[model samples]
Target: MSDRWRTLRRRIITPDVSETRLDVRGFHVKNQVARDILETVGKSFLAGYAIAAEAKDQSIAERRIDALQPRFRGFAYEGAAMAYAVIDGLSLWRRDNSPRFLAGPGDRHIYMAYVGIGWAMARVPRFRWQRLVLPDPTLRWLALDGYGFHQAYFKTARYVYDQYRDPSFTWHGGGPQSYVQRAIDQGIGRAMWFVYGTDAVRVADAIDGFDPERHQDLYSGAGLAATYAGGADEAELQTFWQRAGEHRPFVAQASAFAAEARIRAGLLVPHTEVATRVFCGMTATAAATLAETTRPDGPDGDQLPAYEIWRQQVAREFVAIGRN
Candidate 1:
């Protein structure tokens, strides 16, 4: 079935281009290179969103998304997934279309697609949340990561400056709900990388400003963003690796996660390889393999979800290996 009022919905959903600009967001601007990295991600996200919001079918959107270069292509998929989630969540006028995208072209970018669902959560109201397609219990927390990233990126002053936690956040699994904030903090940490303009010192300082308990998760998020988005050079990545200190294992774990995301999406680039080397002491391929092999098989656990268990496994392995 064709999506109704596709044009009108597209106009309503897509954000303004200027809004993602550093100056518009009043975020740090380390240099032109950093500025480009941040802006390119924004542009790529918008492009992907538009592809989904306006395209007639999933196949059309896939073709357009595949045309993008490796580094930015995954971001576009992320944006497209966000659009699909939004469409499915808000478009009660029709049947769910998100599954089509998620099961097909989006399968490879599943990590990003979940994050994209989180982006939809940020835009879609709580009442409509039930309609969203979040079948995978283990990876569902990633939607919060996307929501956290969205809030921290857009509401920088409230989230980043004040370090505000939304006591009202309602999403929780059958197990302990305490991990909710930790998952969100990871997204906030990811946003901080862009907020700090990819400056290793500034990013580390921002992480330090957070509550001590949140440092590890924050480092994990920032590590993923740094590796995936890739504005920093080899030295900068090494600097970030050193700055992680005791949290290096989480950073290493997250770097591996990023590697797997890129590799699965067929978007792995040299910068990702370099970042993986610095953090995981291995190539992106090896790091991704570790992430895959270590991933726990089964449903959500009684205490910790499978996602957290997987992350812990990878982190422990890095700690044991002596990250450099």
Candidate 2:
């Protein structure tokens, strides 16, 4: 499977070595593996949820997720993390049966997972300051693109009420969950960076309308997006970095993580040279060197030393730079 992924990645990434084409024919092939990655992680989440549900303890689910992290690999590892958010959210929901945990964007699994994070945050006594706020664009896209799934899940299946249905229940009846919403919205912003490529102005504008309080979230999303799908000139990215303000280091680190994740996923190639240079302040060659250094080639159930080295180098560079 790894070899096959390499082959597919080479076919798409090497052919153009310029524009990252999303509309090209056979693009679905690229996503087939991504979909598989999502599925595998989803199954794991369900299994974890079952354990937590049976034990009547959410910590059981958290422990299951912690145990599975080293097992997660490849480019779509972050996607798996997203799935775990759902399990975590559901675990909390099963424990307390709170309405907040019950709310989500219907059955859009990704959106549900995002909402799950919000749900978890709401119930967790630790992060009480965090609010549940879904950004406009996140809602827009999920409603538009995922309407069918939403309708099937919310209307027909009634997933929100599956475990416990209240006769007078309404989605958002008790108000909204903001923290995870911002996080997910930030991820959407990052996706936009890739979708729009180097069009920094457009990406910035899209998230600009968001409330100023959420700029940090937007910047975090923008940083990861720029790192992975960036094509903007340095000045444009610098402007973005400045907007992130004190959070610039955070954004930069996320960018480094994005770069490494892309490399591990087998999606990185010379074509993304511009992104590496702009976001990481490193030549594509240098960035690729780190990618090769960090490639997870260890035996299953084993930790790889290269992974730590890559992480340390990324952290050191970003910390030294401090901003941008």
Candidate 3:
């Protein structure tokens, strides 16, 4: 099944030998994989952000995190840590649920988001502060252009470490969880860099290596080894896993949500060459999920209009990408 999906994706994404590239302008939209990724991840991220926002009183946010502690147990962290975890969680959830080949636009959005976040963290102070405050920005400007998006996943990881520092943000006597987080972050960052900075073949390689299924455990283990391998035995690995367990579920759930969202958004269409496919994929997914799952009285309901507004903006962006 996985192989079939891969072949399909390749056929959809890659042009024939006679052609230079797939004319992504108007391909078919056979499956719903992309929509699924967007919807699911968008919902989870929004939920986390809302919780974080309402807890703006710091003490309030801490309490909310505490109240949600059982569900997010091993995943506790401060400030940006929490934000990034939410994003990672969404990615994992999508992967766990869907066919691997149909990442499409939702995957693009994640890459874009990471690039934008990295750029904001690396360049803009207001953007960084805004991210720390709100996490997910409604404004479509959050998606950076190609040049700005060139930075790899690991580059962003390094930036995260450089920008934010907590002397106490370590694991259970092992070392700083940030260290492990940094590696995973960097790995993903590098993967994105390959995707945007280079060619599709490189992107494929990075995706293969850093894929959630194959690399998640390896990345986790590498982090543990880095933080606790000094003088410890097998106990260290077990302890590391115990501490990180809380985050595992969050990651899985969030990834699933992301996949679902993409499908609903229509941005995950088969061969559409519309540049905004990525943005539409994300916003559409978020909007659809919010409409279905969020109560009329909930924040999701309130954000529906906002999502629509953003969708239009994304459409414009797609036109712009196509023009260029």
- Taking the candidates one at a time, how many backbone clashes does each contain? 0, 8, 48
1-324: candidate 3 lDDT, tens digit per residue? 364553453344221322111122111221244223222322333333344323323344345544432212111211212333233233323321111111321232333333233332333333223322123333222222211222332233432223222243222212223233433343343333222222223323333344354333232222221221111122432333233333322222222223333343323432211211221223434523532353122122232333233333333343343311
lDDT of each: 0.89, 0.40, 0.29
lDDT of 3 at 83: 37
Q: In candidate 2, what residue range of length 10 has the lowest lDDT sum?
A: 143-152
Q: What residue runs in model 1 are displaced by over 4 Å at the alpha carbon? A: 1-4, 172-175
lDDT of 2 by residue, 271-303 (tens): 245555655677655654644454344321223
TM-score of 3: 0.24
Expressed as tens digits, the lDDT of each residue in 1-324 for candidate 1 is 346677777788899888879999999999999899889999999889988998888899999999987789898999999999888778757647777888898999999999998998899989888778777777788888999999999999999999999988887334458788988999999999999999999999988988899999999999999999989998998889888898999999999999999998888899999999899999999999999999888876777777898899999998888873
The numbered model that scores best in TM-score is 1
What is the TM-score ranking, best to worst?
Answer: 1, 2, 3
Let me know the TM-score candidate 1 reaches against the reference structure.
Answer: 0.96
Question: What C-alpha root-mean-square deviation, in Å, does candidate 1 show against the real structure?
Answer: 1.5
Q: What's the residue-level lDDT of 270 in candidate 3?
A: 26
**TM-score preference between candidates 1 and 2, better one:** 1
| Candidate 1 Cα deviation (angstroms), residue 103 | 0.5
Worst 10 residues of 1 by lDDT: 170-179
User: Each prediction's TM-score against the native?
Assistant: 0.96, 0.37, 0.24
